[model samples]
Target chain A: MSKYLLDKFLYTVDRDPELVERYREDPAGLVTWWESEMANSILNCHGDERSTWLAFTDEERTALREHDHVTLFEMGAHPFLTLTLFIAMFERDHGPLEYQIAYGKAMEHLTLPYPDIAT
Target chain B: MATVCAVIASTHHPFYYRASTSTGADRPPFADEWVAKIETFRETLTKARPDVLVMVGSDHFHQLWLDNMPQFLVGKAPYFDANWYNEEREFGLPRMTLAGDEELATHILRNGLDADFDLAFSNELRIDHSITCPIITLRPEADLPIVPIYTNIFAPPLPRPQRFVDLGKAIRAMVESWPSDKRVAIIGTGHLSLELGGPRQFGEHGPDPEFDRKAVEWIANGDLEGCCGDVTLDSLHLPGNATHGFMDFMLMMGVAGEGQKADHVDSLDLFHTMEAYFTWYPEGVPTP
Candidate 1:
């Protein structure tokens, strides 16, 4: 009935810088931990109606690790946080210009007006 | 009787540093001049010596989350703290505390509910820049006790602007009914026009001077309908991420009394954000 895991994952990473760092340090390990937590919570009868983590396929995990934003967006990740994650990733690797480019692409995907990047 | 009712509109986060600090490095060109004006305004507030100040501001997703965001929140805590984190700490604002007026706040909650306004009460609300920045700049000593009423602007299904005005009226009524001889001042903190965390987050796409000018004029003139009526969600959203802050201004104008004239108006255009300060004198209140 709900994609709680995906929502919680995106929301947590968006609001918590430390979690973002953990995810950046080890995406696979982070996802594994999340899956284990979900399993433990479900066993304890404290789970939501449905967990997206339980339904996530191997290909989806690969896409998440590969930074395929479109795939994640289609899978129901929050658009704003998706864009924020993209900018954060791009900024770390290729400076501010690449971050702007990533922002432009994210805006295009979200159908927001493209911004005139201030020089 | 209330001694003063003012609207101090400002950009909350990054722009807060512009007023709190003396340095202008990496800030907009108008930073120094704006800081000077705010300092003068602070002097006026000090001279007023209000016993209790009711501050209206909106939370920026720091305290509330998507799980349960309240439209209107009143702080009932005895002390309000600015629990800053990350970028908020960059402003170098020391851990600040403002005495809270629990009695007045409780009365507001009761009055708001009685007036058909469902209000959320918070005993542990941690304020963000929206309220703290203005306090640090205008009332650093925190001498006057404060009552904070938070309106929800970040999330959808935001209370209509008229609702905010009605809430202000409710608060005014509560203050009028109180038996105490305390002089109260109501200060609304927020921006006129600006965007944040959107596509133009880093661009010079806003502070729409035309819109800001009209808004300030409407507020100063105490024209509630002109300021908040027919304000569409699309219009607010299109302007910028945090343009919803205008709701706080509407609440302040409502409290200042309808059709009352502004005794003083200080407006500054900081390119990306327009800041307006207005003090309205209700009938028989001699201007200080």
Candidate 2:
């Protein structure tokens, strides 16, 4: 059941808006379709010495950013998805549920919290 | 009776990819994770013994990376491997010999494009885990043939989600039209998460039960629109590692259809939900 459950978890978060917001003023027009996994993965996608994403990294963060566009793509944060961060900070919190359940094991594997595991 | 099985996609973390490893790092740590993967993939291959395995997934800069990457790319190859290199880790590489069903694959591509879905092609690109993981799960040893599909989740000029859905419909038509008598196995792989990177780590390893519950709800009941949001929905995460290959899954579903009642497999065994779809025909239904 756990394995089956895991698959279900993959599917649920894979396609749904793991993060979003709905305010009375905006109503239907304001529903933010945010994919938490990409945001999470992007957080960990630091750049190496040779990177296509280096130019995008700010000077202060350069030594730390390992920032590469190609890696950024791998983070699942496509250029098209750049606006999600804004959606997240502005919208309601998706929950601690996906994070809560998978966090422990994820930590065990040394797998960062980039892709909100439980979603 | 003839059949062609296929796999689908969504966003996935290729451990060898830059985001998964260190910066300025050219080579990835391969052997450790891959050998382990090959070891396990063998068992599943033994269980669902099929004539051919069709692996459908999205493409990154790997193939087109060298040659102007396209929004959508597909390949019919005799062998597939991942030259995945991690700057930090030793990219333990594993090469697998895959079989190609050119007739079926070509038909599906042509039809999908005929329906106006800009499908691209390459004879020389290697595939990532998007296809390999499921393959490893079933055929850990790599003694079989595979059909590789490319998607546009990562690059631009990608087809719209609904357009991909239509591509799925075309795929269904192409599959049903195949003339060979083949028992095929298709596995759709991807993540079920929208956010990647930063503090949002879903934490690697094991099933996240809450996320698992929501995933089940979407699949079991057929809430495509509700689960996926408006088909017209667009955002940065649209082609996320989790959602990247989703349309591929939908395409397979369209091809597999609900008429055949697929038995959902247990998920805990692996990181993905391996649901078995059915296409069993009524004993007397005369092969269509």
Candidate 3:
């Protein structure tokens, strides 16, 4: 179990909640939302990375198996992501396995360590 | 004697005394050891002393965003008493007349499209710190007459990777094609590090030194083939917040030329960062 302090990885999630939310479950919405969201983020960056991130549109997120979906365990997610995950988990009629698998796929990108700087 | 001109570009790393000496505090990698490097660039520029300079660099949210964004912006007007939002470096040049190389700009647009790029043409954007930063640093003691070019690389649909290389070839062809045999030395600015405003920005990355070393090595080896190598879309999506700015270097490279060996003159390493590039030109070329 990896622990994440809030201050470190917060911006990666907080800065783009609306788009990250859709990518978590809404497949159709993910396409349109990410296009504009990525544009906004890339323009703010420094250099070649601008054109670099644009490639995300073509990258298919690798899917996780049904048994592995676990949004609650994602320690670094923004408060909004947790909220979305909660609603999808309890209030929905979908099978528990679907949420489990979906959460797993999304969490991989989410769980990447913040590359913490420790002196 | 050929009339030589300079193109100044850089990371716009600001240095201030009273502020936090932590490099990433005010601006990542600025106040740290790179402070001396930026000052050294100014010194070398003073020594090399070109007659006229056409600065090539990018702008932040300084001029365009949200309400307005120009596809491709160019500023050929004299900028005296320009604005500086952050404590970044101030413009060091006095106001002078500026001319739009409508000929060059038109050629870029035409060639950019022929080379499969979409660029909006404009003559009315404000001169940004990206251009003014290196200008003031290189010639802090005096202001030189200037021409400026801007790219939407920070924005989107950035010209294809190869297009940047062609842009360099196009500009060189255009410059030499012109009757004026100006003493021209092109500069490609920006960095080899990936620390941005993210949390890790306060500290250095383990990978940054490796990245910096590889980049400078390519530059010194005159690896124009590698320098302007394909900046694939996947690599651009790295963690740093400022990775987008490197595209501006490609725009400058359009004029810098291939097989041009860069003799590294200075390198400042701190917090896993290196602010460096090849020499302005080889000894064979008549230097200023």
Give the runs in model 3 whose Cα sits over 4 Å from its true position: A1-119, B1-9, B16-36, B78-81, B86-121, B205-207, B227-230, B282-288
Comparing 1 with 3 on DockQ, the higher-scoring candidate is: 1
Candidate fnat values, all: 0.06, 0.00, 0.00
Q: Give the better candidate number (2 or 3) by TM-score.
A: 3
TM-score: model 3 vs. ground truth: 0.57
Over B101-215, each residue of candidate 1 has an lDDT whose tens digit, in order, gives 9988988888788888899999988887778776876787778788998888766667777887888877777777766778777777767776544444444435366677778
lDDT of 3 by residue, A1-119 (tens): 12122211122322344533544466445444444454335445664454433322221221111112233233222222233233333325465235433443454454334332211
Measured by lDDT, the strongest candidate is: 1
lDDT of 3 by residue, B1-288 (tens): 233344333555433232224334445444544557666566555555555555566655455543356655545343423433222222122342233444445544565556555555555555555555565556554345554556655545456555655665665564454445445445545655553323323243323565556656654554557755635534553534345556655555545556555433566554424455344543343344
Highest-scoring model, DockQ: 1
Model 2 alpha-carbon miss at residue A84, Å: 20
Task: Please provide TM-scores, in order, for all candidate models, with all chains considered together.
Answer: 0.78, 0.55, 0.57
Residues B101-207 of candidate 2: C-alpha lDDT, one tens digit per residue? 67656765777677776777766667766676555445545556666766665543456666555555565565656677875655555444333332333334313
User: Residue B190 in model 1: shift from native, Å?
Assistant: 2.4
Q: Put down candidate 1 lDDT per residue, A59-114, tens digits, no spaces.
A: 66665566666566556444445555555545667753456445544544443442
User: lDDT value for candidate 3?
Assistant: 0.45
